[model samples]
Target: MKSILVIHHGQGVGGGLIALLGLIAELKENNRVHVLSIFDGIAVDYIRQTGATVTVAKSRFYAKFYQLFIHSDAAYFNIIDSIRNNKSVILYYLSKYYFAGKELKNIVFDYEIVYLNSIFISDWARASKLAKKKVVIHVREPLSRGLFKFKYEIIRQTINKYCDQVIAISHDNASRLDLQHKTTVVYDPVVTKNRSQSEYKLINRKFKYFVYLGGMARIKGFEQLVESLEYLDENIRIFFLGGESEYASHGLKRLVRQNLDPFFLKNKRLIDKLKKSGKIIHVGLVDDVFYYYENSIAAICPFSKPHASLPILEAFSVGKPVIVSDVKGMEELVDSTNGVFFINSDPESLAHKINEMSQVTEQDYEAMRTACMTKYKQIRERSDSVTSVLNRT
Candidate 1:
């Protein structure tokens, strides 16, 4: 069987997981497939669901600081312990990779392909160019606003040359940076939830709820979206459902406080208000977001930040009216025909779009929803494209 190694940087339930799922679907067919995840999260559960054995780096701390001290004593011990016992991992990491960062002298792989994630760690592998291994450099986000100026040029430039192939979550993201040749645009795959989607159909006469999904990461424009809610009529509720980013969720919480003060009171009161008048549902990380989307009127992804996002697609897949910012990857997926796009990423513009959505007719909304599902199907079919490339190599 062909040998293939898959690496993941962080374990957020985002594009990486879908990419992992896609790769697993494609690469594991009649091959000795192995995975090395730098971090762990819900994605780990999904990866295991694919039935592939996951052999994480002995020291994931090595992923970012492997050259220095190995992070996660547990992982360090696991790898060392396994190696010392001579427990032969069918597919395994190189010794030096955990012990000596860039100094990782040699990697003995008879495999034809090494599909990798995280530009920080494995980028070195590509840079080392020790063998004829095909490397798939997966990038899910654009550099931060500050780094967008020039800070990333060094690393990105290196990626242009070192990487054998480049896979971006969206074409807009690929074009956003000065990437070199051999780049392919692969949209993030939709996570298929076992739970059925919400059956609540959006009434096109006027929107009742506005939705946004994603951990409250810095680039999601969380504060701005929450702040904008103050200007809109209280009749419409804005529901947020996603994990909160450890760093930025605090600011998002603060913004929520500001929006609710002197306005919304108790949960029962808010529920009653929404029932009588629409109110926001803060269902954090629901089992099936499609359920929420089906009930909701419009799926909102007005992220002003520079990164790829998935909520927009999740909303579209279920035929929800989507409203997003006309920036980066979002621009590629959302258009006036399929969904609404606001040029201005401000509260007023957002509120205006919400107001506009409130006026869409049922027929027009259905047409837009149909357009979105068509696009969703096209993207879904390409979900395993990266895995195909990795296995073929």
Candidate 2:
């Protein structure tokens, strides 16, 4: 059996973490697997439950360094701040890179293959290559063009030169970096609890609400989703199933909302009104979102950015249709057969599509549900066989 070292950059339990856990479960069936997490959190506990050995590098300095790298492209830095912190930032970057590489090189010598869970840790590919180990990177995020072009170029060149193979979560992500020749497109494996599990807590059998999975951040088109309720009838409602995101666009505004109450900060009066009227129920981060998906008429994904959402797959796994925004990577996953699309970032359009879906007849709805399962199976066929990709690497 091959020995694999899986390195994940984040500690939060999001879609990427879920995908990585699924991968580890499959890989450990025949191969020896070890996980190196950058920080310690509940995610580490989840990884341990997969029966894989895990090492938590809970480095506060490394955490800050990683955060800077992630948010460098954002408008978080001003000229004054840059001028004041330039020298210190450069020193910190160099020291962190060198020390981290040295530590990783020592850890990787025990494994035959080094698998990077995200592009953020692509620099470690070089250390793995130096150790003469096979390097495989799972490209989760789209390589967008922005202020971080130089950083992206470095990552692109690193993967092309040092990595043996690249596993992109979506075609749109691969095409962005122009790594088609070396990239294998593999959708994330979907995981769900059995139907015999307990029912949704707040939602009763007669509730007419759609489930919204994922973070409640502006980039996720959450604000637009909230506004869309204005157009829908008072009886129609939304059941938000996730919590606030770490990297949301407006951090200060979100903080204010958090201080006021953890549920929602945007459209405050409207949200309060909806909650009191039993029109909007925010169920933050449940252990099993499957019951929520099973009971809802459909799942709604209103992401403005390019995303390979897990909600669409999770919804389809239970024969539930989706109302997804027509954005890159996301739009490619669904069509008129099993799902309806709305204009990206347009709440009015989302509401219109929701109305259309709500009005679908019993016969049409059953057919759409069947199509949803069919689409899910087609994707699952690819996701389940990812062991072949590891074999090649």
Candidate 3:
């Protein structure tokens, strides 16, 4: 069996982490897998549960310190922004990365392949290359134009210099990164073997809920989902089953963002009002979301940005249809046969689509469920794409 070391940027339990867990689950079946998580969070336990050895590096402090130099995409490409942002701490930030590379060398010698879960773990890629271990990077996010293009150039250079193979989660992601020549499009697999499989009974309630699984970030169009409540039928309720984002999860940051950030402030008021009205239900993070998916009529992913969501795949794996925003990475996954698409960031359109989903006749819903299961089976068939690449000499 191949020895694979998976590196994860473990800040939150977002789709990337879930995708990595799914990959680990698959890899452990035929290979020896070890996960090195950059920081400790909710995902550590999940990673350990996969029967793979996992180590938490306790680097959250270092990661936050590094962020002081390059906080955003603009800082990466704009010289003036980069200088202004890192003028005081550039030396320290650079030193941290240097030491991190040194530390990685000590860890990678025992592994044959170092698999980076996302492009964000470039340091691991570099260190793995230096150790002469095969480096495989999973490019999960899309590379757009403008300053992002500059960031892409940097990423391109990294892959050309360091990575033996690059895996993009979608064709859009591969094209956007301009890495089609060396990139493999592997859809993230859904980990269903460990999930609870209770009998799914359609809830006999007046209000049918649509499940939303992800972080509470603006990019996720959560606020937009809340606003859509104004347009949705009273019988339709949305059940949000996720936690706060990395940016707004801590003390002062959370307090300030929840109070000052217009997005959060507005959504807070609306969510509170809707929760009481029974139009919105917030059931924080759960260990297993199968029950929620089984009880709901459909799953909803109203992401404003281009995202390859694990929740959509997980929902489909359980024979549940999805109402997703018509965005690049997501739209390509679902179509009219198994899911309904709404205009990205448009609350009215989202509500309309949610209404459309709720109104689907039981007979039609059964057909959609069949289609969803078919899609899930197709994905599972190709789930070994990453493992296949790793097994290559």
lDDT of 3 by residue, 262-354 (tens): 555566675575466557677677656778888888998888777677788889888999988876767677989999889886899999999
All candidates' TM-scores?
0.72, 0.84, 0.84
Q: TM-score for model 1?
A: 0.72
For model 1 the local lDDT of residue 300 reads: 77
Model 1 accuracy (lDDT, Cα): 0.59
lDDT of 1 by residue, 1-393 (tens): 678766665366754566567557666777778666555545777788888776555554444433311111112133333343232211123422333233322334445666666544434454334555566777665633232334345446656766777777767567654464777777766666453555645434354777777535424555456656656765676777766534223477546544543322332243343334234456666556666677777887767654566777777788886877766566677777778877545767887788788668998888888998888887787554665555455
lDDT score for residue 250 of model 3: 66
In candidate 1, stretches whose alpha carbon ends up further than 4 angstroms from where it belongs are 40-42, 60-110, 120-122, 143-151, 193-207, 245-278, 343-345, 377-384
Model 3 stretches with alpha carbons more than 4 Å out: 58-64, 68-97, 197-202, 245-264, 382-384
> lDDT at 62 for candidate 1?
44
lDDT-best of 1 and 3:
3
